[model samples]
Target: MLSPSRRRRRAVGLSLAMAAMSVVVLAGCAPGGSDPGAPQRRSVNTRLADEPITIKLYTETNYTLYEELAHEFQRQHPNVTFEITKERYDVLLQNAPRLMASDNPPDLVRLDVQTDQVKDNLLLDLDPYADAYGWDRFPPTQLAPLRVSESGQRGEGSLYGYGINHSVTGVYFNKELARQIGMNEPPATMGEFEELLQAARDAGLLPIMQANAAGEANMTYQAILNQLLDRQTVEDWIYNVPGATIDVPESVAAARRLQEWAEKGYLNSDANSVDYTSMVGRFAAGEGLFMFLGNWQAAALDSEMEGNVGFFLFPPEDAGRPAIAMSTPGSLVIPAKAENPDAAAYFLNWTLTNSTARQTVADVGGSVPGGDPGRPLPDVAPGSVTEQTQEAFQDVAEGDGAIGFLTNATPGMFQNTLAPQLQLLIGGRTSPEEFAAKLQADYEEDLAS
Candidate 1:
């Protein structure tokens, strides 16, 4: 799972915990909706202490963009430095909770909060900082993941995490392949998108370049979700609303569609065997017409493909439908034991509000800089995929179409359900009925357990 670009090197990983999540369990301590055992509510202070301080970070190994941010922050605050520990994205998924619960946890760690880890009081509640910093002005949906409640539900709860740049997923089409297939612009709808897939196949080019291995097939599942389903339905499933279920017509259609595409040979022949990095390499090297991934690849493809790749939000079912994507700011959490909670919170706030830091996040991370929507956008080359994704994020935000990753319904949900079920569905070993039903069963089992 090496990064596609040395500059970004961040994984457009499935669900990035579970995009770059660090997990803590802080249950039932919601003073202003924060963990009870967490640090006492401090007055909101944006200024860093004018004393020698070292804020430790534990994060995904490829998150060099944040490292760059830390260095720049250090330049601004000579009194502050950082000690960052890096691990593979997958390894962090398995261990962030343990790390967060450790006596000497890093101040900030990259993590996505999952339902299973919602039982402990190990993460700081960020409500005080949010009010102090005017973070309520940010897109309400974008910050939904940061809020954990007394019940440990996702959308409404204490703030547990934040991301500097919000990562957005979409389609990256090879411009030349697109033209060869007679695609003059991004497909206007999923039907047109399918036609282009057929066109690419007829032209003897791989229609889509994606890896089904490592559970990435779920990307396809989630990519088309908003097109066929309502945002509330999706939110219910992801956030653990009682009686929320995935076994529905839209979800089944989505599963069936994924299998149909696979059966039609729109994907690479080695799809099930290929890894995400391989998919990026093939799409960038011109072997495929499109790729379904996030802006995390823009910095890489912008370099490797050299403007040959074009990006579009994965199309909706038809015209006028909002094209939602699964995204949030890269999830970072403050551990309850963090030595410099205020400094960590300040740095997180700085990452969002400071134009310089936002630019660094946008430029280095190839993600939409997370901040007040009114704040002007960071500079991006005109018509670049970077620009497209940033604009797309705005559209999604304005439309309120953003949603969490389906793979993150629970910890190991992907490994236990999505990956295996998707592999089976694509392999024709499972039908849409079976696939969706299995997903519902697993979701219920995990939630109950």
Candidate 2:
């Protein structure tokens, strides 16, 4: 019906039309075409960008991930900077009081639970700020330890510190070593645990690697004592309730039990001299069946053993009672002498709820309180160990029995008095009765002071 040139023109027009239609279809498949009214996505700035504030932070130990965290924080907050200072645990503890006494104390401080000394008058109450920032993301159980009584307030208290991570003290066992000695599972009772220790010794393996050189070595003995004595008895002994004495039956029994374990070769020969870092390495090398430590060492175990490590609740001694472990969340406090309390509060808020920051903490070998267990943790030992630790803590918190530790609950001076005395007991320098008497005398003196 048309000439050759006309036909060619028509073909070209049809091809172009089809091509245009294809483009239209592809355009529909592309993003943002169908929804013209859709809101533009905003980028989340996790750091204090453009904020003209600087906060000084003091902490113990060096962690690479924390440096990364600081960098990421700086990236998000271009105007905000951190002045960070790190020291060894003992040095940090020793310097904390001196720093707080000065006019230029650090804005943010990472304090040990036992050093509740500075917590009383040196830290600021964070109730209003925490409430304003919606820190209700974590439950009260996680926040209880950091709460302090406000000045001139009888019953009212406010959180002065916030902890990004928690540590649980418990027994870490080597599964391979356990299997070699026909122990496929962890001990559920103290008696069974003792038997396991004996078995490990018989197999020519060290049963327990205790780091007694560190002044904190007494922490282990305290943990053992907690299992033997009720919370009220411990509190009474610590507070020096009239006529209360560690020389009583309970303290004597706990000391004797520890002495028996040491005599039975349950502890390493040079345990009194081993430091914390060395103790961890020894356990990792399979030199021992079990080691008592905090979950702060989780990252190390994850990196070294991958999944060969397992955790157990402190085994129960009395029948019909559930076993539990000790848990203490590290705290971040603002010194009363802080030059920048407002900025410190802002940083605290940012750290607590920031998803990436929390994940970084978990990755670096610490567990977030009230965090989802299903989250991926790269260097974690095993989820099962964490679960068991959590379960034990929950039992202690929920059970009709009292829930707390003397080291954390008692005043700093009293803790100091007890630590060295307990160490002497462990080193076999003090008899059980004498150890109890010394504790009683210290408690009475502390209460009077």
Taking the candidates one at a time, how many backbone clashes does each contain? 15, 2
lDDT tens string, model 2, 301-384?
A: 766876677776566686567544556566778776677766676666655445577666656644544322223322222354
Which candidate comes out best when scored by lDDT?
A: 1
Question: Per-residue lDDT tens digits of candidate 1, residues 217-263?
Answer: 78888887778988889889988899998899998899889889989
| lDDT score, candidate 1 | 0.77
lDDT of 2: 0.61
Which pairs of residues collide in candidate 2? 48-77, 49-77
| Candidate 1 displacement at residue 146 in angstroms | 1.3
